[model samples]
Target chain A: MADVAQQILLSEIAFSYRSQNARVLDIDRLSIDAGEQVAFIGATGAGKTTLLRLIDGRLFGWTGRAEVLGRTLSPRRAAPRNWNANIGFVFQEYALIERSTVYQNVRNGRLGRTHSALSLVGLFSDRDETAVTEAINDVGLSDLADQRVDQLSGGQRQRVAVARCLAQEPKVLIADEPVSSLDPTSAEKVLDLVRACAEARGATLLISSHQPKLVAQYVDRVVGLKEGQIAFDTPAGAVTPEQLGSLYGWHVADTAARSA
Target chain B: MTSEQRISQQRRRVADWSGFMVTVTVGVLVVWAWVATDIDTGRLADSGGRIGAFLGRMFPPDWSVLPTVIDGSLETFHIALLGTIASIVLSLVLGVLAARTVTPPFIHMPLKWLLAAIRAIPLILVAMLMVGAVGLGPLPGILAIAFHSTGMLAKFYAEAIEGIPAGSLAALDSAGATWLQKLRFGAWPLIAPDLVRDTLFRFELNIRESLVLGLVGAGGIGFYIQTYVRTFQYDKAATLTIVVVIFVVLIELVNHVVRAALK
Candidate 1:
């Protein structure tokens, strides 16, 4: 019963590239109950992206026990297609098919749910189309649904990415630096949309970002990382400036200057 | 002068020497080719008169062979069409097998070398062998074109597959797309235009090569050219030549339209 409530649980996770001796991720333990919205804040090379990839079930060759949505992940083999559909990932680069229309790209997210043979020949049920339409409308791109993704603005492209992920109806949503390339205004809008959508669907949300102050305002929990290890895990807005400064290796004077 | 100036002077001297060597090599190669190939300026001058006589005979082409010319030309066009279609099918399979992004190096590397070896064989040589094995006709011509063009078409397709941004496929994979779905959604759209362009280019080349296949009795308008020229029926050969020119121009026009539409 306890496992039923836990959306993600990890223990004794340690990972490193084959060519590197230093571990890239060494989290001792992590647990997130269903519907919890969390953010991972770190500087560059802090393994935030790698950790998100691991939780998304894409990263391989790591030593760890990971359970997401009550299914334990095998380190050697890839996750099953249904399991993958259950955990949608939003890439930092959006990763939309530039030549495809927004509606088509969003429809791709429904592939795992459709009949494989039918989808191969571009056939989809009405349910799939309905989900795709709803996702596009939810992202406020219903008018631009027929337009090619390459013509869209960066913010619109990210919104399309969100729509694609939303179409999956995932139980746990993971975004890796989804707003890193956007302007501040767009970033806030995207972040607000992501959190709001997660809340609307009652899905567990996990996002990684470098902007701690800005990101903390979105998620209820913030887990700060420093060189592949968790430095602090506290409630959002409860993370002190000194803690963030130290996590990013800022001197006391630098922190004082930033506070001023 | 400073050491820096000395180094600059040395580099300039090296560059000048390399340029001189390259020019000298090219000149020597040209002279060697002319002498080794036994090209004679006097014989070339004498041949102009014979060529003029040949052209005079071909001026009023025999229209009596129009039916034969039309039939042979259609055969050639059919051979090219079938060969291009067959090559496209083979290229799709071989191309994916040879793409480094699709398959590991151990699989794709050997396949690449095999494709290169196929490309190295001349089309005429392949056609000759096909005629020997298949007992001549359009079958040999079709087989030869299919075999010969796959070398280039597959390589072009492999390059097209490799040109896709890796992240696009990875994104699909993360979204739980099956292997075929990833290919359909991720690889297909990005490479469809490139594949069409390559296939059209190969089709044009196949048309040209199939024209000559008839010289070896593999079947095409080239057979009439061979027979008429060998039998000294220059008037008939001239008619076949004109029809061949029209066919080639028509194909080129269609190819241009298709490529434009793709764009």
Candidate 2:
């Protein structure tokens, strides 16, 4: 088994957009352990997604360090060709390339591991074809594999996105609001899929969502953020209703009143 | 209401319609006046007989000239094909430079202006200029067609790149794809169909442009037309016109097949 104590670490990271004169992200220190399911909950514009981008090394112009699987993040550093081979990301919008077929979209996850220029020029590899089909099957989207992504429903597209990540066979899965755009049933099913996939692969799961109830039910740990800063980092069962309110700027009474 | 009141309302509505008609008549008259200054309508009417006489002489299209035009028509097709291929290649590079997503505004703005300037020159004039420099035949025609095609293809390619869905790019970036990888995976697949369609359309346009280029001593069926017309061989000119039409129809059929295959 992979060591559960091994962690992805981000230290003293700060980033700002060059086009805009605002500090979009700031983090002093954060660590996510392997095989742990961590959820980030915060209000809109709290930089939840930005932090995720930073960890993935998508956002540059940042100070300090981000180390994933012990590799320090740097633009000059070629991400281990296999870096994404072991790290899967589910975008908030379920960013499946709309023009491509479901099989092609899922197959993209294997890009990091595929043989180089020669294979691409020849345009056929049995291994890639099999992996892509298996991923579609895993997501229960076998019937829709040949369909264009734009033709799928919102929920179906989201499943395709998840299948893409699954195809990567990652050891760390990062999903930003994987279910926010989904209906309640779809949302539950997506969350269930993410949890089951992470547990099965023994991968650390870091998912961000605004819904506290879903997080509490599905995640093993919750990392709450307020104003781009961590407010609570605790086991899911230990996160009180007061803590959830503070994270979202809602009072417990208001939430309870609304619920009643 | 009384009949008198109803008649008065009808008269007001007729006045409104007459007012609108007067305004439209005045607008038409102004435009007609502007157009009539350089145009001799009386002379045009008088020359109708001469035009009809010329048309009558163009009949009995000399079928013997058909074999001669086959060679010139093939040359025109070659010019269009080579020009379109060259233009598509050059434009792809320039288009990437002009795309705002790939290049900063500082780079994109100047490159866009250069393309605009290139497009400003008429293709016939371009062929004439090349004739002055390179001297006659298909080379000048190819160069002219290529220059015009570059402007059009570059503009279309840049727009196609810009229209790609943002989600795929964001996803690729998050996955740590390099700029080249992002272009290969995220950008190209989305824009390829549009690019292919635009290329086919440009090829169609280039065939017509190549015929015009032949006016400036560039080798094409237009060269044959010029020769036949200068020698007052109306029958031969008519034969060349028919040949050009046939070539265009055949090319259009090929384009349809290529487009279908690409789709």
Candidate 3:
């Protein structure tokens, strides 16, 4: 291990679905350093999710050399055992197990780190239980810990998802449209939580969003994708209106007008 | 054209009320054909008096015969429970294999077809075949129920697994979860309630099926019903029928409780 640096590096990565004749994602190179809060902004279907999947190590059978932390990425790299302990993911739909209690769902973040067979048998160590409770509290969901996820509002469910990620105590947090389902206020709250948690843990945060305004508001750097390739890599303040227009084309004016 | 004329024209193009009406008509026709073939309303009317008389005889349910029927009903429950257990375990594996989200088409399609073939065989025939092959006992009944249940359970389980949000599995995969780990964390949690509810529902169905299996000498209350009816002991026959109904209703209640807990 090369000093266990907090960075993700990808080079010559390409991915495509079985049904897709053309590649959905093709990246020549990309890197995010330790503790960097990077936001990916792109038009719809611009391979934002695909790139996230590449970093997350979900897409296989792709031509690529990537590394997260000190581990090298390979087609033969086994599905991550203890990957959850190092990387946390928040999904667009929240993805909290609907049938599980909020506590159980949050506790799942620790699943990669927790002792095996014990959690499977529905038993958790006292330390694990405390971690779960603290995670729920961190997300401001202590009152709803016992509630089933299906009963929760969209915002609450998103919090539960955050709590799940929090429990993992990960080194990197990757969120894929984490608040696209929420109202504006709730979206802001989720973004705030993501920022706070990422900063508190000194963890690298990589979030993908279609909303450039939100990304500009919270993220340190912005990486724009257009047609499955990097369009711009710049500091959040440096992402000018012209760059935004080039990234989204004619829709940038519509987005700016709507924001106005 | 007037606004009303334009609106009506658009409605004519967009609203397929005629198609809806045709679907309803076809559905009614199909149902009518089925009823005409399988049901004899006139014969039912003629036999209503005898049925009423039979009901009168079945009154008080011969509670003294309860002990005799209890053992068989318990046997039926045991058979269903064991069969459900076996089917649930097998279905989990087969269902994952058949699920397109979990497996490649080359694997999923064939597993799906295999389950469909299993489902195509009627449960009674399966029981009969088991009885023929394994000799007359609850074991054959259990085997029959398991086989029939494997098909139904696998089909439903595959659908349940498929219904899971792809995002969670993607997240798990990204997190480096092995296929089994992905299933354990991402897929299993989402589908557990559905699996439990479906298994309970299947168990209820199997209980009824075990009765049918009794005709093939698979020991249960159905065997007693067949024996009493054949021996012309109408009283014992009525007693067995009442017992079976009560048993089914109780199982249904239990199923409801299990579903509630799972939910």
For residues B202-244, could you state the per-residue lDDT of candidate 1 as single tens digits? 9999998889999998998889889999999999989999999
Query: On lDDT, who's better, 1 or 3?
Result: 1
lDDT of 3 at B157: 93
Number of clashing residue pairs in every model?
Answer: 0, 0, 2
Q: What TM-score would chain B receive for each of the candidates shown?
A: 0.93, 0.83, 0.82
Clashes of 1: 0
A118-207 per-residue lDDT for model 1 (tens digits): 999879999999989998999899999999999999999999999999999888989889999999999999999999889999899999
Please report, as a residue range, the 10-residue window in candidate 1 chain A with the lowest summed lDDT: A1-10
Alpha-carbon error at A2 in model 3, in Å?
16
Candidate 1 Cα RMSD (Å): 2.9
Q: For residues B43-69, write the lDDT of model 3, one tens digit per residue.
A: 989998998987676555556667887
| TM-score of candidate 3 chain B vs. the reference | 0.82
DockQ metric for all predictions: 0.69, 0.35, 0.44
Q: lDDT for each of the candidates?
A: 0.91, 0.83, 0.82
User: Order the candidates by TM-score, highest first — what do you get?
Assistant: 1, 2, 3
Global Cα lDDT for candidate 3: 0.82
